[model samples]
Target: MISKKYLIVIVGPTAIGKTSKAIEVAQNYNCEILSCDSRQFYKEMSIGTAVPSKEELSAVKHHFIHNKSIGDKYTVGDFERDAIQKLDLLYATSDFAVMVGGSGLYVEAVLFGMDEFPEIDPSIRVEIQNNYQNLGITYLQENLQKLDADQFEVIEKGNPQRLMRALEVCLQTGKPYSSFLTKNTKKRNFIPIIIGLEADRSLIYERINRRVDIMIEDGLLAEVKSLQNFKEINALQTVGYKELFAFLTDEYSWDFAVETIKRNTRRYAKRQLTWFKKNEYTKWFNYNESSKTIFDYIDSKKTETEI
Candidate 1:
């Protein structure tokens, strides 16, 4: 009989050391790492997205990091297809693989499959965009909260793209955008061993603030300046870049932008923990837990499956 393959998924909020943990696990299993962080997929977004360091990338052969240009139209569906294909190839030689990221939606796409939404009219989306441009993101946020408070609670509140998409779906269907997300999940061949790293809320916030400061020191401003022309792109509409772009555009002072980045990052980390904790099967470890402890837990899980 063929032994079952395992996909070890390491997840946590930003700045929680998920990358280092993933590298250690991959080295132990002699397998490659596949990144599910949607922000890390772009070639032009290293400092702001906190793409793995050069040493970290070299320590473990990583897939999907810096694999696409900001100009590319990649979606969760594309990542799910690409990641599964890569996992299939990896499993041909090894019984284990690692996937690590903070992007919960993308991780869900790879694990259970993307949620199916009804086809929405293009005109509704266009109308929403026009209103967003004229009335701003506040309009979208208020409407989504009114239409679907459940979705409003979970979504990245600062993401205009997600906000607009949800709003358009709600308008087009005369129903909450989240109602369509209840479809049955798709099955996969490999069993998933999910490990989550966490810390006290105060500690997580401190780390996020320190990391943002380090990004600035690492020339995040220069990186954002280089991508200023593409500021309107969906990928650039994220936290760090968006705040800095506002500074560049004279909409915010430099000090205010930096502070906003830290504040927004803390909020993003909170949302990440909320999303990952919903999975009852996730084996969570403290942020400072030793790798040996985690490895032993993973081994025990694998053994149980075999038995």
Candidate 2:
């Protein structure tokens, strides 16, 4: 049975104002926040990660933001372990805690312990990375299409990381990566109230474009430049930094790079939505709705159930 103690999770695709809304909830319940944003782990990536605003940080205690160096090799497994530990401490001090982000894998890492895949040889990873560098991400996409046509329909072709991982497993075991998704969900003790914030597709795209512009005004370019020395860092392999890195490396004009950031951000948000929509447990809310309006729906659900 789920614990009666509350663990609120505010989630959605990127730019859905989850951080701000989480702060509001924390203030209301006098609880702390455990961030699940995979990117915000890096101390050096404030603007690019769209981390909590200063005011929001000041409003409530937040754990796991800006706590790791860019070079640190962290994984969802690590996050799951650390978050559970933090939750234990937080639960000791308060009856509730808010966890929030758009990271589907990271969120699942906490709520459901990630299934451990057999460790692939390091050479397998190196081989796949080399192939991606030589033949491009399209090569991996084509491979996935051939291996698992159904998965190819939903997978993003632009993300080399996912493509390479799938390709690596195929090359190593001659099996589709999707086939290895065989683990059952691990039970959790805490009560998770998942709240997803969403908007119309066009509205989400507009918000992403506007957010990219605001990120520019907030010094994303300078932030990227300062981290140029660490361009090869895995943390810097993200969308914003990679786009801006192209400009810094003279591969693209700054204008084109900025446009690419907006375009890629929109695609990322779409992928996030697709990933989150898979879970039947989430209750989605429109960003246009007032907090009271959304909370009323949640309250009604709670009253209808024993929760």
Candidate 3:
């Protein structure tokens, strides 16, 4: 008989200390951490994306960070496939591996597996992309809402990729994207213990604001300026870059872009909580709590096992 493999997932909103705590747990379990963050994938984006520093990386082995380039195209579907493959190899070495990130969908994509979504037509996507560039996100968002209200409500109307995805589904399947989201969770061979960190809403906002300030101080503007040519890339449309892009284009005063980053990050964290709170599998802990307290809570729920 074969023994089952178990994975520990440390999940939380950004700037909540998931990486440091996850490193501690992984070291204790004698294994590496599997990062689910999408932004941290690009090697060019270190300071802005908060890719682990050399000192931090030297402390514990981490997988999937700085593994891809923003210039290279990758999708959530690709992430799901690649992560499963990586986890298989890691599981062969250790029964328990820590997977940590704030990317809710990417994290869920690996643990439960996504539904079989329909493929989109290339022309339809190109058309939508062209319209987004010409008409703006608000215009595209209006169209998506008219096509699929359910998915539109869930998506960040400002996000081009999400709007494009919803429109792609509607155009290809002639059905609403949300209708297909009935999420027949494809079963996986491993069991995951999910740990979520939270804090007072005000405190979380403060941390996010502080992080944005720190990034600016750490040369995030220079990093974004280097990628100025790639501003239209889907990955560059993310929170940090979008804010800086406004500054680069002279649409915002420097102070305004910095302020928007903090504002948007707070809203992003709120949406993250909304997404994860629905999952009953997650056990929440305060972000500022002692490590011993967190481990005690997690240990009570976890069973000791040997690979």
Clash totals for all candidate models: 0, 0, 0
Q: Write the per-residue lDDT of candidate 3 for residues 21-106, one digit (tens) a residue.
A: 89888877788888898889988888878887788788898888989988899887799899888889988888778899988778
lDDT score for residue 20 of model 1: 93
RMSD (Å) of each candidate, 1 decimal:
1.1, 2.3, 2.3
* Top candidate, metric TM-score: 1
TM-score of 2: 0.91
Over 4 Å off, model 1? none
- Candidate 3 similarity to native, TM-score: 0.92
Superposed by TM-score, candidate 2 places the C-alpha of residue 230 at a distance from the truth, in angstroms, of 1.4
Worst 10 residues of 1 by lDDT: 177-186
Model 1 per-residue lDDT tens digits across residues 144-232:
99999878877888899999989998998899987776266898989999999999999999999999999999999999999999999
Q: Which stretches of candidate 2 lie over 4 Å from their true place?
A: 1-3, 148-159, 300-307
TM-score of each: 0.98, 0.91, 0.92
Candidate 2: pairs in clash? none
lDDT tens digits, residue span 109-194, model 2: 88878776667889989987888899887788988889877556555566677677777777778777766652567777677788
Worst 10 residues of 3 by lDDT: 298-307
Instruction: For candidate 2, give the lDDT of residue 217.
Output: 98
Pairs in clash, predicted candidate 3: none
